[model samples]
Target: MNSAKLSHRSPTTDHGSQAFPKELASSVAISQSLEELGWIPRPKLLALRRLGIETVEDLLTHFPRRHEDRTEFPQFPREESDVPICLCGEVTKTSLRRFGGWRKIFEVTLQESNPNALSEPLVCRWFNLHYVQKMIATGQRMVVFGKPRLRGKRICMDHPEFEVIENDEEISIHFRRITPIYPATEGLSQRVLRGMIYRLLNELPSTDAGLERLTPSNLAKGERRDAIRAIHFPASWEARDAAHEHLVLTEFFAMQMLIASRRADASIRQGEKHCGAGALLDRLLKSLPFELTAAQSRVISEIRHDLAASHAMNRLLQGDVGSGKTAVAIAAMLLAVEGGYQAAFMAPTQILAEQHYDVLQRWLDPLGIRVALRTAARQEESGPLPLFEHAGNSERQEPQIIVGTHALLYDKVSFSKLGLVVVDEQHKFGVAQRAQLSAREPAPDVLVMTATPIPRTLTMTIYGDLDVSTID
Candidate 1:
């Protein structure tokens, strides 16, 4: 490995002299509370927890937002450049100028530390930052990164990222080699945060961070444990790039694992066969003003398969606008009704709920399938129908299909036997709201419908446990 411009502050892969004893039992597991380590000060622990970092794993995974190559400094700019560059120089002069009614500008004139005859001074300027003025002084060696612009005969950098080079360099984490720049908060500085991460990388067993190698042989390059360390402070650019690719693949693999687990879980839950022999569904299809498209027919068949499943059906129906998703939804609802259960249709908005109610009532009122409409603003039930009484049914004259907004979740609304719940625009509601509706006796079969365009990766991740049927 090239050791050019490297730092002695960081621990090596072979657990250099900075390595702590494995006897520190608290550091053995990745999930152990950082508080148990006893090395972190109380204030620092509070700060780490505020950033949602409470475990050894959290600290290990706090990868840098970016790394800056400090192996060598760029030559000081003689002209304006749009791209930002990092250069090391010394402060030759400092001054604070007041302008525009109490506004202040802090300017520090820096000359390249090893200036030749051709080098020109670079000016670093900050607006209305009095704190920056207090931290800088003449003759101090500093490293600065920013875009250089020609301001009245001087090459100037505005509001640059900077760190004063320590006169004695061995203790400085900000100087030499590749430096990490992290996403910092109010109380934490980049130097302090970088030091904290570097210490943990060497002091604790990063393999204990709970991420084991899950990829197949030759599928990916390295162990995920080594990737974790390299992601923070890589030894070379190739290693850094490889670590990033491995970590990203690890993330997708983890998501797939969770999705697989959920799919497995849903497979085992016993459910009632909610599908009927297609008497009512056939009537509704025959009554439609138009014919069902091939795609719609295919999607409806998929839903029928789910309804016939032994476990309660959990399905997602996706289609574009102007497609016949509503007609297919109604077909699925009628199947549950024919199986001797009520079907609840909930829309995201009152207007959508009322619209669906109007269409259902118009189509089904003549067919004797009772439809009701309920919203936060309106409650309209079609005239009383004959009671649908069977064994252990508590409801008398219950509407077969009740369409409503979130008002469907109200205590006043009750179902004799809610066998299916169809949520339109499934993305608008919270998880608890969607879940509470299905959390009932024998678990009502859930059929969530959405017309909103979503990326396929996200759709799979969010609804991983549910059966998917797309009209397109």
Candidate 2:
């Protein structure tokens, strides 16, 4: 293993008497933040930060937008599919035509040299594009890509994106392999970012960023490092493909390892067991105009199981728009209330928090449950909450269900016995923000709800720490 400096501040810690030099090891190390890059000015640094590239690690993880396959031209007799078709052909004819002698259209007839041509010729037509008439001549060879449509008897493509092939040597340089197009910000060109990445790679040390440490048993040193290098600048299509596979697998593997570590922590962490579905919960359910859906019942059962467990419940409840996630959350909060504890419902924005407060107040207030609304905007609104009006008695002062935005994390906020926290639109809050709400005497059971369905791959990557239950 390479003895890279793990310290954030002192890149070079002394080894024995001789001080280790700060060379490439300190320059490209993952421990080094973007602030240490030195070349980036304040303005450019802010721009990079806006794009979420804050560290050497972040910059490396910012993958390409799309890889352009500029290799071989498509074979003759193109098959119809959703993907755009690419073809290299010669413009046999160019003509200026008008509809009703007013609307202008430029038509360029393209024909491949191959005898296996599908129809008469591929007609490339542009509407009101007068400059195209002057650019495309009779014998110009160009590459055009678009979906082909049947126009009368001949196969034609309408306004296909094309580029003129200037010389034969250009094929090897631009069309012989895969070329990556990165996601760039304003004032940051692709060429500039590519140049910066290449410079970093060249200056990167062997002990840099502890890349070798992450190289698994299946991947050799060159395999992992070469993949990182090739992903940015590939020599061939085969190299790019192999590099993509290695990086993707590494991402999944890292995510799996993180999930394992979190699971180990969850096994030992203590949590409250609010197992009862008491009178308050039953009254609220029965008072409702409608019945709970089968999906809702199943999810509520899962939450009940988590609440009964000794370990903390870190669960993600996902459902469509009208899947009754709020009802399930209400039931969980009532469980906490029955256990002589308070609960919180956190939303992403003020409007969402207000909405939850309104809906919940109607249901809980009727059942003699105290609910409080707290938001940054609410501080300036009128006066103290109704729960605070009964400040003389601590029992009456504490709210059973506190609904609010991120404002609920303010230092002034306090709960009597915060046992359960339900976060709506859970993606909107960062890990630290969520932690702040759950950090109390005897850590609370966390139930995160999201209306949007995430892809399975993304769920495993982002929410792997949480046990998941889907309503749909």
- Which candidate comes out best when scored by lDDT? 1
Q: Which 10 residues in a row give candidate 1 its minimum summed lDDT?
A: 15-24
lDDT score of residue 426 within candidate 2: 91
> In model 2, what lDDT does residue 355 have?
87
TM-score of each: 0.80, 0.65
Candidate 2 C-alpha lDDT tens digits along 399-442: 77788898889877778678889999998899899988886657
Task: Give lDDT: candidate 2, residue 75.
Answer: 50
Model 1 per-residue lDDT tens digits across residues 22-119: 54343446777889877888888888888888888888788888888776677788889888888888999998889999899999999876677978
User: For all candidates, what are the clash counts?
Assistant: 2, 1
Pairs in clash, predicted candidate 2: 70-175
lDDT of each: 0.80, 0.73
Candidate 2 weakest ten by summed lDDT: 10-19
Which segments of model 1 are wrong by more than 4 Å?
1-28, 79-82, 102-104, 128-141, 150-152, 164-172, 206-211, 346-416, 427-441, 452-464
